[model samples]
Target: MIDTARPPSVDPHMSSALLLAAAVAFAAPADDLDLTPGAWPMFRGPNGVGVGADPLPADLIRPENLRWQVDVPGRGWGSPVVADGPEGPTVYVPTATPDGTQMDVLAYDLATGEERWVRKLFTVAEPDFTHPTNTYASCTPVATRDVVFVHFGKYGTAALDTKNGHTLWERRDFECDHFRGPASSPLLVQFDGLSPRLIVPFDGVGEDDQYVVALDAATGETLWRTGRDPEVQDVVPDLRKAYGTPVLAEVGDRTLVVTTGAIATDFLDPATGERVWRVKHGGMNSGSAPQVLQSPLGVASDAVLVTTGDAPTSLALLATDSDLTQTKGAAASDPALAWSSNAGAPKRATPLLLSLGQAVTVDDGGVASMVALGSDVDGDGGEVLSRVRLGDSYWSSPVRAGGTIFTFGKEGAATTLETGVFRGGADAPPELKVAHKSTLDEGVWATPALVGGGLVLRTEHTLRFYHPDGTNE
Candidate 1:
């Protein structure tokens, strides 16, 4: 629940007026820097589906395969985002001081691991306590050609010029009591007739404060603010907080904002903040973002895969056009509930959607499993196909390049799995095999980005770029 009675320090009216004044004299011309096949613009690339077209080297752990490595200034867990700029392609990452008082975003040259610029955005007088495994800068940024948007939970959200790293606009009035820390990254979406909007979620454990807000991308002006369902307020405060990110999905002819929260997954109209449909999974502390399943027939299924954080189960909810609701237990009776699984469901890492109509998930304990997504059109639930033990803890979600799946362990171990061929037919089970395994010097919690035929990764204290050979293309 958001504390509506507490007055914000910055008046919304004044903030809007200042933003309008600055836009007239100094706003960069918006360009078409939309998500491309080569750019990793957001948390899990396009549509939150973690797959890259470029093929990484079979063995990336060998020292000779390293392209370049650089020591980052501060600590952060947010993954690096890559975009093409006038000079060349640039990598943007967020970091902060150990005390969490100072936060900044660092830009580096994609070709060579050289620092381009650093923009310090916030200086908090008193900071809150973050989880031991989490950092002050856990929210990954979203980028375009002209501007990059970064969010630091309750501290603030700001937009910066991509070329020179200058501030375009900032907003600090949003309120939330993130007891552990903030990890939900913002989403950028543009409808056919609507302007580009940055959607930010504030699903903290505070009272009357769990809501989602959309801001005009050109300027930091609030367009709509929608609160969570009032029924969520009835749960315990800890059960109300969530750290999952949002993804955009096409349902029929309309686009919907599909997001996961404490007890439910919601589908909302992107143009308006109205709820279109919802499914209650009866779980808390959801950390994994929802993933849309694509059928083997080369079409999007009407079901989305979701996980209930800190719970033992994950679920698949059927997407519909009506404003109806269903529960996880209703799978036996309700057609809206497609399936549910308790084997190797992730608590932090988002599941990867495979091409063979199967979903792969790595639990926080380093257990990975493959589950079949039952026919979404027929309302059938699936079962766990296979399970494998990777032998190390994982917080970063896995990404696929070509036929190999990359899993990052918290202890700095990197493992690649070869998705064996389905010899029989398309419906045959997959033969999972471990391809290669290697270890790094430090722990890594940030997900790596694949771009320009190279992999960009962030560990505890440094950022490294790796390619097949020790040369930058």
Candidate 2:
């Protein structure tokens, strides 16, 4: 559990409460577990901290240097997200049917490639519409030491024992149009001294006011439920739908919950569902993750970074709430907005806040560039890492480990670069690149899952693993 801030509200323009809770659960490939070391446990990983201790080879890994590939059952766009469980580090994979009807959750041993268990956690006779490029498993699963939770939107949510595939409990009554089927993944964090809390964001179809839910991870009990309305279910375009996930971070001793979706990026109280402050980015659709970085505490209590724009000029920066309450028109207008950068921002992929004040962005057309982090970036004068054409359009957020950043082409072409200051060791030579890479077939929209010194790459048809020492099995 993390100790939140103990300060009072500097501004009270919004409500104060952590609205979302956890949903859905998944299993990894059918294999003995051997997760990539220092891997991701949930979306954006534990506490939404993009910072990782991943021991990636300074050199890139190429596809021709084959490791081991395993065809996964069913199909999905969700990536193989991993977590350390009672069974050591295990991989939790959420899968969907080709027709997008049947959704399955499989847990695999991270070591030897073997199916630990595959449980049909939930099924929707009919599914909400998702992009053809999207998967019914768009949202990744959330897990703790005891159980893994999966959010299947229209199909409902389920919890499974990490040791075996036994479902500990499930709640299938939650309903959401998910506009394009749920893409916001579940987030886990310690709250009120209990087991880390489960936070889930639910965005229905058009004009539907989205809601955030909090749940007890062990018993599947509802703790709190907060939304954008007093209970408005209208389907206009007031900007209520969202595809982005919620994140938790403390500011000045207070536990502030930040959720970035379609219309608004709101800040709430982690202890309760109270809106402290909120800023409306006012976009029709948003598809990226929110990251909080070290910065001066004021408008946002911290610098909150997000990506927007099918074109450049679509990015913006705003603050999260310090207080939690829905009653607004209060004090502190617009909260705090450090700044927003529209320069070369990724339209589909979430931008990476890199080292040395630089942020790496990849456009929908596969144009990659490293831009400065300050909101006042001129976009004219700065070091341009690479302006070359890469893969087809991409949805996977680039991965940064140590001083190197890794972005995978939609076709599974992995590109690694050395960013700012070295967090692990001295910057490796530019000659060092992606040592190994491969693709199952189709483009991999699902982000790669890192755990236990192993990387699990998922395509629409198969899931593959790459271990250290250039050996994969």
Candidate 3:
């Protein structure tokens, strides 16, 4: 027998009660910085770690504590970064026009919800192919104490003054097909200690093939150029999974140029285009950027970490030595599968590897799992100690803050989970905990950008400021 519970009755006589059963899905923005102490300046908050260093309460507010939620124009998946020049900390958002008529990046004030500045900088000569989920501003802006850098293929790269929305320098001459639009976020590296280099890459094929360009930070002039063998494509190669930006890490006397291909991971000399080593982790459709881990087996050894996947298997960590370019390294350090789980790692959201080398991921299924980076073999490989299945998929990577991990799904559900996962090589997995959550419309895909005082949260059409506890001013 099937028993179906039904509504008993309506308050027919007792005057009709009017109410709005609020229904926007909740997607929690990261509280990675302090609303009273500091601000998130670039891609991964302050440094490129994708972590908010805020000491606020882990419990973020819902409709109650919300300072204010305001709707803006344009649509894209790029997170906002604050450039504190003279006008305090101004939030910068690079948005793309839907019909391709114009592609602009805008700025806002963190203190009160207000439009600080709008810069209609790039106009695509001809828009390139991109994934349904990606946008022109997919690449988050990079900043220094005085400049903000944004990359727009065909349209070129540009640098803006932090004080006023003045063009510091602009480079609208580079040419490369951003097959699936551009998602590689620019990284800032200090030249001597003050000078910065804006490293950005683009696609090309065959003899006149793919390339990664480096521009002088202060001035958007072409400082140097490095090229790669064109990815042999039968067709235009749906470049979506093929390209990525460059991330830096010191290895020996040189910094590494770990660049993601439509499907390949290559290491290049930052000073020169010399590819020091190369490793191919299958699947061309790469969404997130690559992360490096020191030889997990121990310290003092030579090893690097890489993750790839889209429709197929997603998370993978490849430990390689110098032989990777040769047949030996590839054969010897065959990727030791760390943790494989289909917990909804987004096809567009990059996977964030924590300091422990363990993967902190939010899968396409709206499920977030903190899988330990296992060193053990098959029979007892590794384990995903902590996980919480959410109700949506987030193209934005979760920002780590206050011992908790924060991620937002498609509908805008912000899930806060206690990180620190442990494999039960001897004990049991940890319990799942929900720190906070909030609601929003469809486009909160941009990863949370920690800013002055509060964390900046945005949808394609709306932007907001969230305090740690559920309090909205």
Candidate 4:
């Protein structure tokens, strides 16, 4: 149950009647959960590419642009997800107690900041050791027309009917050591035009027990399982763990599931969970995900970009000589080396590949740099396009919206930069132009969500909605 009785402590407040109406509207059953075109369904936008074309304001620093802000309970790094229903839209966010013993999910009205519903899912008797920076609620929720899936890594994974506050299914038997904490989020992928499968990365703390598990999205049953056996042994056991999510890419007639792990990146058949090809990288415990590059026409290319973990993090491009459909064997049919670069690779935040033949990488220390892509970037052709120092540390990945990349630091400052297009060689390298800078004045580690021409940013204690017109309910 949600506390609909109280008046929401929103900054730059609105009328009480409007908030009450919005809260009451949440009682209606969700007829549909399918995300509309302007809705943000999951992490990094719909496709996890970090590109959002929402019509948010160019400058959030403008006091008139912030619509409303509401305080959230507990601590979490998981981003908010928006799902459209028959009435309007609802934003779902998950968080947990500071002790990592109690986990809960909260629903809010997208328009008025009304408390919709709150559901508690788990209570651990003896929680595992997690890094001080990481919380128990680090995995984001994934939603569709019928169901909303919430995952807390090793704690449990559950499905809640978005229409009502009903727990449809729960799976708590999945085991993993996580070493630091659960940072990987759940991803949904469809196979053979059947029901979609929920993919969860269960990379354990040691080499002997890492696996990629897929569960039936409808029933929460085991759909398929793929184990990762990286033969490389490291002195540190945590180096064998990975906190990265998997991305699905279509290669010609074949669909490949590309995932970066502790010591290597593997491409697998999404249907059968069979490894197609793999490239070994010496870096251990990768935290960033692999991004499948797309052509200017938005077509999937054969090249995939990945970032290695540990110190001196490096970025590598793996391009297949032939169609991936015709490839078999992990190491036998490995792709040719396109190139590897160590310039400004983020250890936790995933990189974004723009349509302008450039990839944006933001390091934890706030160094944002654009590198020229394609097979030519590996050679001595001056790949580094431009770099900007934002003077803030960032833990969340940046999102592209309204032709601007919004990079939010951990301490709540957001830097907006224009994404200039890069045509080809001999052209002046694209510069990272600073468009605007704003601060939520709190801590922000979760990736922001853009939906319905609005930008939703979550700080350590508040969720703020920003729009171009600064319309507040």
Candidate 5:
């Protein structure tokens, strides 16, 4: 059980005006507060869905498309998040010193790729062992108009003013071993008439330590904490660790916080942090967040598509208005499972939902497949439409911009696939064509942010901005 007794340290530099603005922003209707063109609020953009409206060029490696490249001071695999500031759009990223003694959040001018501010939030005296491929700063930041929430797993979690990088409030007492390092990003949930909450998942290897905590967004006070069910905690310690992030799902008028853990995916009420339902799956060390599909399989209800960790399969849990629990362990006969497929299921990358009633998933080994979502709930859905081998490995999830899906490989390769049109029906499979393939000089583990009709990518050692017709001027 993590401690939340200590009060958050508030920065005096933050003014009341900014706090009031945050209140007003959260008070606005959800429709009016939809993600704008200038913001990439969370890990994979709004709700971690990894879809954007900007248009990215096919030839991203062309010199003419290189807007600006700046060398980042430290190392991290966290993706960059963008939000509108006073001057313009600013990019925020987290990084740690080579020795892991200092972890900081660096802000940059999105337009010119210039350094804006760097604020050190944590100093670890003795760092724990992390996987060679993972880092202490693997968690990305969530941004609002006025504040940006950053989490460094057990190191700390804080809210910073986006204007001047002032720490508004910080809570540093949450403890977790994070056996492989922290990768789950924080999620901000705001309702029409309820107080805003920042939900953080802590699925560690420690005994009886798997739980989710919600904090008051404005004050950094603990709102509620809910633990993973005891049945799911019976697994081995190594198998209990997870690096996945949580996503919000809208089921009719109710909003549920859907989180994927080692052996189970739990759905919780966003307001009370209480478990609404739990579905047990077969895999451990789950790293990919679940993707929600509305009117899934042409059904009137919504469904959640989840990837069992480190395995070659995925499961779809149909969302319903009633409370239901499925602990039968990834069986096809489970009443909660709408469908299950073993084709191109990702171990790291989150599956991308296409507009043509299809889902695209690229496994860590670079095999991308398109699965046709059938029209009815019968046995026809979850069929593999196509599969392509790209000959690369990926830790970063892919993002879709316009009609192109951009996949960033672990060894610096970028592949763009042009998704062709498909007529509505179960028989018509969508066409996927490789548009362009390019490799960078450095490795890329972080997912890029697509905003303002451009891209902000973080490589192993630097940050680079790209635009379709950008110049070095």
Candidate 6:
């Protein structure tokens, strides 16, 4: 149920004012520096690591604390993105009908949950088939002050004017099968002296037909395209597909984009789409996005960590070495592999990299594990610090805010734990203490958006906002 009572702190007429102001400023482009402090502007916030400075409500299960809950028109699995607007703040998400024919991008006023605009951008006569768990609107929207980009896999990809909800450009030339449906989300990379580019992976089931494409963000022109050949072993060919999103990592003074495909993970130069290094993992069809671990002092490690997809899931760690970095071939037998653990690898949700040098992962079965990065310790890397069971099943990825780690299950339950100690010696075990628990009526599959001292969570049929006390503002 939703609380109809209006809060005294916010004006009810603010929604209309926000819409008007947003319309006037739709022509200007937004950058990372333009985002508000609490804004979550991308897939995993700005950095794509699911970390925020503000804390969520300790008890979101309480109905009274829910600020508002409004029914959504269609189904979607993509997470919402928040940005600062002219009047206040705005939220954007993509949804589609049950038949996968109609695709729409909806924008809402962050203050009152008022629908600002809905743009019916594309309609497919013969839509591709998707798995029962996936929806037609699975890809999340990427937004800036000037425009918002929405992608429906091979169906279509378009840029919409942020102010009036108008289509700026459209592209449908990319060839991809998306055997079980597309899951990779589009990413934006801003360059210093060049136009900003949108990067997305096209790893479909193929023999030699995979590509990592980069497009000019302003005009939707192809800037560069590079091939990706995982050379997967003989198995179900459909398993040769991947549904993971690419992430940006800072290595020394250079920046690289790290992407996981069917049978391997590759690091490429963001500007030219050149391969920096490649590491082969045994699994096929990787769904979890790769995470670059950071040390306690805030330095990013050269090694990247990810969970290999499919049965008998394993966690693989790949680091840059002179020999492997110099060669363009796959590093299946490279000596830079720190460790491989098969304990609790997730197939869908992305892992959380902690500031305390611990990597927290939640598998599809709702089992959570904390592993030490071994940067400060003397033991072999990839040691399990601790483990716990949160729920029966989970699809939403875990996030960190303030000093707490939040995990959500598919059955509407959420667990809050205090970040475990990161400086424990090799002999001491890492531990995360449970602090609070909460729940909702509908199940969750999308990651929640946190900003403006509040949280925006999307269930199967509703979008709800909450205060820190789990109460409506």
Instruction: Tell me the TM-score of model 5.
Output: 0.87
What's each prediction's TM-score?
0.89, 0.79, 0.78, 0.86, 0.87, 0.85
Worst 10-residue lDDT window, candidate 3: 18-27
Show where candidate 6 strays beyond 4 Å: 1-38, 233-235, 297-301, 321-335, 376-379, 421-427, 469-473
In the range 1-473, model 6's lDDT, one tens digit per residue, is 11213221221223544423322232345443232222676777776788876866556446776777778788889888877655457788888997888888988877788888899877888888888899888787777765677787877777777666787667776678787777778777764544476778877775643677776676565666777754553546677788777888776556778888777888877777767666777676676778876444242345678777875477877755334333424343332555667766788888888766678888899888887665421226677778877875888888877777777778887787775445576556658666787776778889887776777888888887766555434
lDDT of 5 by residue, 1-473 (tens): 11224333332333555444333233333333323323688888988889877766777656579899989888898899998966678999999986678899998998888888889888989988888888889899998767788899888888777767777777776678788888888888876655677889988888755888887777666767777877756777787778788999876556788998877788887777767678776676677778887764453446778887853346454444232213323333222655667776778788888877788888888888888755444436678877777767988888988878888888878888877644456555676678898888887898889887888899899998888877657
Clashes of each: 5, 91, 35, 2, 0, 6
Give stretches of model 3 more than 4 Å off.
1-39, 125-131, 191-195, 204-209, 230-236, 239-243, 294-304, 320-346, 355-357, 375-383, 420-426, 469-473
Q: Local distance difference test, per candidate?
A: 0.77, 0.60, 0.59, 0.72, 0.76, 0.71
153-199: candidate 1 lDDT, tens digit per residue: 98888888888888877887778898888888989987556668788
TM-score ranking, best first: 1, 5, 4, 6, 2, 3
The numbered model that scores best in lDDT is 1
Regions of model 2 farther than 4 Å from truth: 1-39, 63-67, 191-195, 206-209, 229-240, 296-301, 309-313, 319-334, 375-388, 420-441
What's every prediction's RMSD, in angstroms? 5.3, 7.5, 16.7, 10.9, 6.8, 10.7
Question: Using TM-score as the measure, which candidate wins?
Answer: 1
Write model 2 residue lDDT over 176-268, tens digit each, in one string.
Answer: 676666677777656455344567777665443377776656555566667764323433643445677677765555667787755567776
Candidate 5 regions exceeding 4 Å error are: 1-38, 296-300, 311-335, 375-378, 421-427
Residue 466, candidate 4: C-alpha displacement in angstroms: 0.8
Ordering by lDDT: 1, 5, 4, 6, 2, 3
